[model samples]
Target: MVDRDRDKAAESRRILERISREADTGGASLVSRATKRARNHVSATDADQDDWIEQWGTRIGRVLGLAICVGLLVWLVMFLLRGA
Candidate 1:
């Protein structure tokens, strides 16, 4: 029973480690793919097209994030000015 418990713990630790690595590496891959897409203006192949779409999506996300941040800042300023 003790050996079985140790084996289970070891397996769980490995699974957790794998998940951590994937999460850390996945973001880099996405960023690199997006950068590659940005560099290629003309995508003659399907993969290029896919990367372009991903980059476009990332660009739009950045824009939206900026807009939200600006809006929040404006709202905070107004609230402070109003003494709310």
Candidate 2:
């Protein structure tokens, strides 16, 4: 019974060692694959982001300016009407 227990323990250790080695190799492969994919991907650059922000900012500024002009005109008309 003691020998059987020892044999079982040895077998468990061998299995664990093989599993650990396999896991390590698998993890390394995963990292390498991810790195390769990142290198190949053409993602957004800083210039692209800056251009996008500037484009939106210009558009928003124009809209806001138009709104302000319209609002001022409305207010001026109301004031004149009230005074009259």
Candidate 3:
């Protein structure tokens, strides 16, 4: 009876381990695929004529971001000079 119980427990443990490994692999694969797809979409160079609006929008957004960074830097410099 003891031997039977030990064998059953061992089998259950093995099954659980296999399931855990499979779940880990599946989850990782899903995330990897999603990331790769997003990267590809972002890096794709093929542009449609209708994408002009999007292109302009991206450029404007980048310029705004740069302006914000420059403004922050200027503010920091002014603050430092005032403190000094």
Whole-model lDDT, candidate 3?
Answer: 0.74
**Tens digit of per-residue lDDT, candidate 2, span 2-81:** 99999999999999999988677544677798877544332323224658876566556666776799999999999999
Q: Which stretches of candidate 1 lie over 4 Å from their true place?
A: 1-50
CA lDDT, every prediction?
Answer: 0.73, 0.71, 0.74
Model 3 scores a TM of: 0.41
List TM-scores for all candidates, in order: 0.41, 0.39, 0.41
Per-candidate clash tally: 0, 0, 0
What are the root-mean-square deviations of the candidates from the true structure over C-alphas? 7.9, 18.6, 9.3
Strongest candidate by lDDT: 3
Q: Which pairs of residues collide in model 3?
A: none
Q: Quote the lDDT for 2 in model 3.
A: 100
Q: Which lDDT tens digits does candidate 1 get at residues 1-84? A: 999999999999999999998678555678787778654532323233557777666666666776799999999999999987
The deviation in Å at residue 50 for candidate 2 is 8.3
lDDT by residue for model 3 over 1-84, one digit each (tens)? 999999999999999999988677554677798888655444432335469877666656666776799999999999999987
- What value of lDDT does candidate 2 attain over all alpha carbons? 0.71
